[model samples]
Target: MTQPGSTPSRPRRGAGCLQSLLVLAVILGLGYGASKVFGDKDSSSSSASSSPSSASDGKGGSWEVGDCGGPDPENKPDGYRAFDCDDSGATFEALEIKSASILPNAIQCPAGTDLIIQVSRVFGSGDNKKGGGIPTNTVCGRNLTGEHPGDAGAGGGQLVKGDCITSTAKEVACASAGSDAFKVLDLVKEKEQCPAATTEPMELMMAMGRPYDVICGGKV
Candidate 1:
């Protein structure tokens, strides 16, 4: 018999094996916790590294002044990819970058801008496929020296507020005093007609130039 509090007989083989298994389990648990903590940090670092510094350079960022892009052949506003002013497909050039919350009624461009491009409804994709309208209007500008990218140049750009005529070459001849021409109608259905009071109506054309199925009226 063993003496009081004296060492007992050696444990059986199965008992020893059980003790060893418990020690291994504790070690694995600690390792998993440490990995989780470090793994999260690594993931965060990777995300920050891939992000672009400015919206002007980022793939999904808002456009900046002087940026250029356009819609597809179908007249649908694409991703508005930025392109050089001389690029073949580039249609609209950004003149101002307004906050999404505050949009102005008239085209307010910086001095030296010769033309103005107004975007009323910009399309969206993915979950926003149904709608992706900007909070305010996006205005683009160009000089009158060269040809505009899209065919909708007729009646586009800055115009006189009064009566006007648009030509296929994207030139607007206005009879008004002021040199500002904003679109009165946009994106109408095919074959749709202008209002009765409209003295001069311009047909919308393809590309970013003019809205579809619509007409623009002005005074000379």
Candidate 2:
């Protein structure tokens, strides 16, 4: 991820090694802007409990878990509109909800989280009552079709140098010998820098909001 005031680094060229880079495509395709402040602001050392209840965006709109939503082009009071997860217009799937008071600095998402949505006004849970007050909440979710970077472990891993990638753009173990698996020999800054044996010089478009482009795969 691109941190404020920090230069973005390239993916490693070593075998089975990669830097953790969470790709945020929402900003580019869905009009969902990303903030530089992504770290957890919660003071508690323990993890907060999950809330599946409904929450308001202070604009009379409410949402709950298992819901898929995207920004409303009409600029409705909800600011966002819900859609079926199978719908092509759906951007993200809500996975968890937490109190905003716990996150004073930044919104903390779950391990597999790809997006974060914070509501300035909450209801039916936490400090907010049925009438609604100043209490707030944060929603963590995963992008419906965004790429996952680095070794996300059980969550999911994205394509990186030294990884064996499938035609579908999934990162698989290097040991998996198959026609679909292609080993990434190198990661270069430009397409021209790729080795002569390179077959697929896929350019990582604005990964983590990096200033420059990243071309993956080449012959050793």
Top lDDT hit: 2
Per-residue lDDT tens digits of candidate 1, residues 11-50?
1112111111100000001000111111221221101111
TM-score of each: 0.31, 0.34
Candidate 2 stretches with Cα past 4 Å from truth are 1-62, 76-79, 102-106, 121-135, 149-220
Q: What tens-digit string does per-residue lDDT give for candidate 2 at 1-220?
A: 3321222232222211100111111211111111112332122211122222333333444445655655544433233345556655566666666555433223334334544555444335333422224434555555555453222322122223455554433444455435754556555557787767778665553434332243344332
Per-prediction CA RMSD (Å): 31.5, 17.2
Model 1 compared with the native: what TM-score? 0.31
**lDDT, model 2, position 40:** 22
